[model samples]
Target: MKKLITLAAIALFSTASFAQTTWNVDKAHSKLQFTITHLAVSDVDGIFKDFTATIVSSKPDFSDAKVSMTANTASVSTDNDQRDGHLKSPDFFDAAAFPTLTFVSTGITKTSANHYKLNGILTLHGTAKAVVFELWYRGTITNPMSKADDAGFQVTGTIKRSDFGFGSKYGSPMLSDEVVVKANGEFSKAN
Candidate 1:
């Protein structure tokens, strides 16, 4: 009987080990994007060229995670040179004074099999605000390019520009004070 109990315990421990693997954000292939209203008739989308996050998980508890991200504010690209320049000026992100937007997660909770909620503070434009993003695990695969095990996720969240002390000069009826942010990133086992 004691032998059987020991065997069961060993099996459980082995299962736990295989369930989790470390993932490092492949920043070169990941992207963080934002969209805001423009002129009340169109939408301008921009992407931060560089950003990263760390994700960890355990079986049945995807909530076990540590996420951190750093983005270059000056890398904003709207596909238009002049507009992109304006977005980096004092009237908008003011990239000169506030060079980066960063977030470090406090925790992550699995709301359901397919949905997750991440609690973190977003520091943008020199102000910090507690923010939550609804995140979904897109799935996992073996990357063809790197021939490595990897996973991907999509995270969506919204915050009032004013919440980060960014809307004063840029917000108006045409350019709404509300902005939406999205991140689509993939991570691979870190070497």
Candidate 2:
């Protein structure tokens, strides 16, 4: 009877291990980008050159998942050198003080096949606030060269810049308060 109980315990542990898999962000195939209105007319675009995301899920459908990401604020670039420098200064992100922005998932709800609603807390410029994003799981593929599983995803969200202590000096008429954020990434199953 003791031997039988030990076998059962081993089975349970094995099942749990088989149920979950962790994936590592493929930085070369991922991008984090944002767009904000400029002069209330045109749009200014920027991308964070340095960032990392860790994803773990219990199933292929991703019904239960944990996701988190950290991005370097000083890496923000908007094409023009002067504007990029200003964005990293105190009047804007103050990247020197708050070098990174982070997002941690609080909940993940599967809306349908390939679609999900992701709720999380975004910490930017030393402030943390709840934000919801729409995500699309683009399915997984096996890499031919590496012989590993790779998962792809696309995400879209919008946040009020003012809520994150951004753009107060040139408010509304000159610069819109809303900022649109987007991401497209591929993750490789960690060995």
Candidate 3:
């Protein structure tokens, strides 16, 4: 009986060790940016200057990966001081009330050898909604600069600002409902 209990404990620990590996975002090599049409005429671009993400997976293909990220709302910038201020106000993001926007994956499905569909819930403006994004795994490499194992991925998606409580209250016609978001980054495997 004692031998059987000891063997069972070893098996459990081994399984847990092989079940999940965590990766940390290499922020210097990552970006969280977006673009939106201005007044149905020109394009306006912005980025979240502060953000972080974690990726955990049990498989080499990352089909079982869990991803989560958070971005500081006040970090949004478009190169125009006045416009940036307006975006930080209650009329837009209400950065003071909702200081951060976050997303946590609910599912990850492999679409091809290197492509995947990431389904998750995004919380913004104090509201949570389902969002699906496309991700392309760019494989892994040993970084020439850091000499560390790094994995790369690209993500693209669109979300309606109005769906998250950004509406006509702030003369919404001046801004489009849909915001195009993109992120390409390398993550380092955590020890």
Candidate 4:
């Protein structure tokens, strides 16, 4: 009976250790994008080309996962060169003063089978503010090319530009105060 109990304890410990997994964003297959209403009549889309993200989970369903990401402010691009340059200037993101923006998850609440409310602190324009975003765990599968487990996720949220203390000069008419954030990522499980 003592041996049976000992074996059971060992199995539980092993399973707990094996459950912890780390996933790195596959940059080649991931994109971080945003959209803002321009002149209150049109929408302008942009993307951050240089960024990195990681996820750590101890459950296969990722119910208790922790996520973090960093993006270079100067990497903001809207396809148009002149507009991109202005975005990096002091009038907007001020890439010269604040070189990077980051987000670190503080909590996660499951809303459905594959959807969750992700709460985190987003630091941008030298200000840090708590934000909540919708997270959708697309699912996991074995990648044919990498021959490893891969997971997909989509995150969407809306943040006020004034919340971060940037772009105050431009009102809603010229540049909408609300910015729509969207990101899609394919993460590769690290060995």
* lDDT on C-alpha atoms for all candidate structures: 0.82, 0.91, 0.90, 0.96
Error of 3 at 37 (Å): 0.7
Compose the digit string of candidate 2's lDDT tens values, residues 1-191.
Answer: 99999999999998986687888899999999999898889999999999999888988877777889999999998889999999999888899999999999999998999899999999999999999999899999999989999999888999998998876787888888999999999999998
Judged by whole-model lDDT over C-alpha atoms, candidate 1 comes out at: 0.82
- Pairs clashing within candidate 1: none
Clash counts for all predictions? 0, 0, 0, 0
Pick by lDDT: 1 or 2, better one: 2
- Model 1 poorest ten-residue lDDT run: 56-65
Candidate 2 residue spans exceeding 4 A from truth = 1-14
Q: List the candidates' TM-scores in order.
A: 0.84, 0.92, 0.89, 0.94
Best by TM-score: 4
Clashing pairs in 4: none
Off by over 4 Å in 3: 1-17, 170-172
Alpha-carbon runs more than 4 Å astray in model 4: 1-5, 8-18
Candidate 3 C-alpha lDDT tens digits along 1-191: 99999999999988986788898998998999999988888999999999999999987778888999999999999999999999999988899999999999999999999899999999999999999999998998888887888999998999988789875574446778898999987899898
Model 4 residue 141 distance off true place after TM-score fit, in angstroms: 0.4
Per-residue C-alpha lDDT of model 1 across residues 39-131, encoded as one tens digit per residue: 787777889886667776654345576678888889989899998898899877899999988998888888988678989999998889899
